[model samples]
Target chain A: MFRERLAQDAARIQKQFDLVLGALSDVDVTQAMSYATQGGKRLRGFLVLESARMHQVDIDRAIWPATGIEALHAYSLVHDDLPCMDDDDLRRGRPTVHMKWDEGTAVLAGDALHTLAFELCTRPEVGTADIRADLALTLAQASGAQGMVLGQALDIAAETAASPLTLSEITRLQAGKTGALIEWSAGAGARLAQADPAPLRQYAQALGLAFQIADDILDVEGDAEKAGKRLQKDARAGKATFVSLLGLDAAKARASELVDEACAALTGYGASAETLKDAARFVISRDS
Target chain B: MFRERLAQDAARIQKQFDLVLGALSDVDVTQAMSYATQGGKRLRGFLVLESARMHQVDIDRAIWPATGIEALHAYSLVHDDLPCMDDDDLRRGRPTVHMKWDEGTAVLAGDALHTLAFELCTRPEVGTADIRADLALTLAQASGAQGMVLGQALDIAAETAASPLTLSEITRLQAGKTGALIEWSAGAGARLAQADPAPLRQYAQALGLAFQIADDILDVEGDAEKAGKRLQKDARAGKATFVSLLGLDAAKARASELVDEACAALTGYGASAETLKDAARFVISRDS
Candidate 1:
């Protein structure tokens, strides 16, 4: 049931992307923007819709932040795959934006997608103006220098440092890189409803950590074809990851524990939170 | 006197940059962000501050959007100067971000600054929540795929086209590339006050075109030391510019005429708009 809902939400958000990007001129950059935003897992968007459903926020209103987070995520990936960054040629089973169009298009497309995230959050249908402002402000905070970019910068610096990062250092990096957006997505429902987000925040904190651990484990064990991109790059780079730091068995054990804590964080929501609990479980178990 | 006010506003906005970026952790990305944002004309920011003053918006409130536009402009320049783009090595008489650091740092810094622009627009002191939301929304429109990015994409396409861009084509490109943000900056005060933005919008339209024409003239004739960048690259590349499309004398005359139109648009504000008229005149007269 949770998987079905996740798939449904992903399709809906895909339509949202069409609506927004279609309104732009038919320039190559816009076309590149469309291409880059396609084929994400859409887990973040799912978290948004499920949380909004938990709060009784209308789907029509929920879709804005749902699509916004996806766009933001897409923008990050496009730039991350740039020749100057991760230098990856493949993303989501296709050529990266730079490989397909060129770096200038890739950069501009990513930049446009970033702005579109704010645009979606500020839409009139999203909520009251206060809510819209809060959403955009928090989104910026989660994605900017102090958040995802900070994490990425640290990662790059780590690549050239004299020594590998410690476990704690890796944890701090992941918190900024991947954890911030996950927490924000989990809490968006409460933000939309103007409700206290402590429980969702707690839930997301565990979920995000578990998610990263799973990613580390997948890097070691998962199939690249199924994952739809290059795998084992972390090990190849000799970078420390959850699996490397804790050993594969210990990393798996830790991820399972984090999932339990995540499920516990949703106890206040009662049975209706079952889908989110399933999501936490799936985070650790998914082949991809 | 107008130049003095412009410089004063620039200094004030620079301080705002320090206050905001200083609060972030001293990461390399933040350092690169500070580097990218430093040393610009700050004309867009001045337009915001001056128009806000005309609308009785307090400096405390007005400074948010003022800094926001500059940050946006800075991000555009940083990305535009990338090795894959314009490949500029010097900006504002100093090494470009990529030259100072690496391409990864430069890309992350530019992305962070882009987000910072929205963050500034959504600040609590900016005004009522409605106004803040409107500012962010309009800013995304002006700077995103349909605006500045569109202009940039078109410019890149022109570089490889079989024929040089015609006069009408270059004009359309400039509208998105440079004119959109200028119009947004000028209209921001009216947006803050919930007043009609038509007059300021009119003023900005003429002023923005004149500003680009002046830039073309500078590219052809200005001293590199004063302009602080390369000159005649357009002619060397055989790219058609305002000066190349129109004779140099005709281009100068057209810029002067547009300055008159820009100044005329402020007649609704009467004597209180003298500084803005001076700014329009300075657009064509200054070397940079």
Candidate 2:
């Protein structure tokens, strides 16, 4: 049942994504953009479309913003793969952009992708000027220095330290680095859905935390091939993880609890909430 | 006299710029924040404030966007100074950030600055959500792949080639690389001023071209000490320049013509246009 739903969602969004990716055709740029975007689970885009559907928001109106979220996600990965940051040579079983090309191209590719994301969201045809502005502001808040950048900064600082990080420290780091984007993804969908924002914010916060915990669990239990990058990279880097702090079983339990909270936040929306519920489940159950 | 007016404009905007830069600092982000933005000519900020003043707009209302433009300018310089781009070792007679820190930190610093620029502009106090959104869209258009990025792309393409680019090609390159930001700086200030955009855009286009020609002339004739970069780097890189394609005297004549055209755009505004007139002269006549 879950597989069917996931496949349906992917088919609906994948064509548009491919088209958008096609627009970036400089060989080096396309290569780097593909490396950053191609292998992802497409979870964020799913949330965008799913949440919009749950509220009966027009899917056509939502596609551009959804793509914008994914593009921003792709750009973040390109920079994260750089030797100065995670320094990982591989992603999704292929060489990272920096490894395949050079750091310079990787930098430019990420910069281009970042700008492209905004341009995509702000297209006059996407929605009202106000909606475009709202989307841009939300995305910028989540992706900018105050949000993802700060998280990455903390992640880097933690990497070089000898001492283990406290639980709160780890939460704070992930909240910015991983959680912020997830929150933005769901929030963007909700905004497009024109749902009441009070409940939407609640749903996003729970969903984001749940997603991060599931990722932590994957880092511990997933196979290297299936995970698409090196397993145990977080541990090797001496970065903190929920599994390290909570133990594997407890981490799994925590993820389950967060997912439950995420689902409960949608109680007011009833049947319309099915896709988001499935998306929450997918975050925990994925191999990668 | 022009220097005195420029100095006054610089002094007025510098205080606001400093305040915006200070607000960016927190305990964790201060080091990178300072490293990315501590010193520069602040030319873009001046344009923002000066343009706003020309229309009798409130300077306070103009400061945020002005600072945002300056931040964008600083971020571009940081990236341009990297090893893969202009490969400069010095910026403003000081060691470039990449030299002062490691390459990775330099990369992150640039990214942070870029994100910070948008964050600053979109702050609630800057303007109405609509105005902020407009500013964000304008800056993104000016700075992103279609604008500065395309120029940089052409620049990288030109770097390794033996062929001399035509004057039109060179103009397109500058239009994207240097001209976009200058144009946006004026446009942004005009937006703050609530000036009629049709005329402002025309003025900005001429000013942007004039600024590039001045830069090209400076590369040929300015002293290395004042330029704070290698005077012959453009020629060595096989990069097209106004001086290279138009010859020294022709480039000088063309630059003057552009400045005159730029100044002429402000004629209808009468005495309110003095600073802009001085700015046009300063662009071509500056030693650095």
Reference contacts preserved by each model: 0.93, 0.41
Model 1 DockQ, alpha carbons vs. true complex: 0.91
lDDT of 1 by residue, B115-212 (tens): 99999999899999999999999999999998999999999999999999999999999999999999999999889898888999999999999999
> Model 2: per-residue lDDT, tens digit, A195-235?
56656567777778877888878887889898888888777
User: Model 1 scores what on Cα lDDT?
Assistant: 0.93
Worst 10-residue stretch by lDDT in candidate 2 chain B? B24-33
Per DockQ, the best of the predicted structures is 1
Kindly list the per-residue Cα lDDT of model 1 for residues A1-288, writing each as its tens digit. Answer: 888999999999999999999999998899999999888789999998999999999999999999999999999999999999999999999999999999989999999999999999999999999999999999999998878888898899899989999999999999989999999899999999999888998999899999999999999999999999999999999998999899999999999999999999999999999999999999999998
Which candidate should be chosen as best, given TM-score against the real structure?
1
Clashing residue pairs in candidate 1 are: none
RMSD of each: 0.9, 2.5
TM-score of each: 0.99, 0.92
TM-scores, chain B, all models:
0.99, 0.92
